[model samples]
Target: MKTSNRSCPPCRSWASRRTSRTRFSEFSPQEARNERLLTALTIDQALDARDAFAKALYSSLFAWLVARINHIVYKGSKRTSAISILDIFGFEDFKENSFEQLCINYANEHLQCYFNMHIFKLEQQEYAKEKIPWQNITYTDNQPIIHLLSKKPVGILHLLDDESNFPRATDFSFLEKCHYNHALNELYSRPRLNGPEFGVRHFAGQVWYNVEGFLDKNRDTLRTDVVDLLISSSIPVRYL
Candidate 1:
């Protein structure tokens, strides 16, 4: 079920969930306060992050409910007749995309890679083993694209996470670092000589992502003081 926006949700509801879940440290302000203590963010920025955090919680909760429902509906099925549902967001491209768009497109890249492996690579390999006479079908291998966005150490996500925690980091700095690291990668490119924009060559198409607010989105957190107040307030329910 979709959450209602008519009433103010228990601000501490998010905090309660964070407290119960050892992971997702960003959810609770008490535990998450020290993370950005040194980082200087404006009041407007803090409010924006709060809104983003709430949305993230709703997204996660909905995803969890879907998983539970699927388990209940598909339980005890015959292995031979069982089916897998690959439900995920479609490839997205807009005139001005941000961190969310990048994440969606990255997931698409992984899905496309999975398709290529099963449809082209694995099938062709099976034919070769059987000595079957068939034409080889080539497909775009998205491993390079995956590596561009998710490789260890210097990957875009690693850089983003690192920048999110660092007090001195900014969106401009994040994009500049990405350009410096991925300048030579074919799947990644600089769209302009200046500004916080980068281009990624996805299976569907190339998308230009603006790095504005990228760092803050990556570091999803609520204001510590506001959280303290919410934790002390009474609420109808708290889902952990």
Candidate 2:
């Protein structure tokens, strides 16, 4: 429940020095003109404040929804079992796919790897532990693809973020960096004669993602002006 007490510095200074008059007519024409100019200068700050307010409002709504669902599912006196189903979109490959598609496919790859581990590796281990004889089953492992996407300094996402920090970085530069680093990787490829795009040999299938806007989309930066405005707002939720 703690709230930020910060107010816009210029506004605060103007307010503190203003005469204690209840009506706007008491102010001189020059004073009214100055007030209008101050208002004009703070327009951007006001817009940022509104954006922060909207984000807080939606976050509170979703939190309430989650709380309600949790209460309904787990608050009963009697023990009961319930099934929760999650519906995720299938792997997407659009003509002009960008960073979002790459993320979705990466998530799908993780899920596939998890399924393989549980259905094959773990089950085999359990059988061996129980001393039950069974033939070995073969399955495709996606560790290489996952490694390519999440490796320490050379991973695609890492490279993208790194390049994004540079002032003059572009999507083409990001693509070139990916190509140079992952050129030796079998799971990564660049299409010959095709415009800025790369392909990942996922466990399920191969997906070529367009590199346009990759750096910009993955940047995920919030303007400092917005942060300052949110911190200076009168709304309590803006602090949170």
**Top TM-score prediction, candidate number:** 1
lDDT of 2 by residue, 110-185 (tens): 8888889999999999999999999999999998899999888989999988999998999999889899999899
lDDT, model 1 = 0.72
Q: Which residues of candidate 1, in runs, are more than 4 Å off? A: 1-43, 63-85, 225-236
In candidate 2, where is summed lDDT lowest over 10 consecutive residues?
A: 8-17
For every candidate, C-alpha RMSD to the true structure in Å: 7.8, 10.5
User: Candidate 1: TM-score?
Assistant: 0.71
Q: Model 1 over residues 15-50: C-alpha lDDT tens digits?
A: 344442332223323336556333444666656755
TM-score of each: 0.71, 0.65
Clashing pairs in 1: none
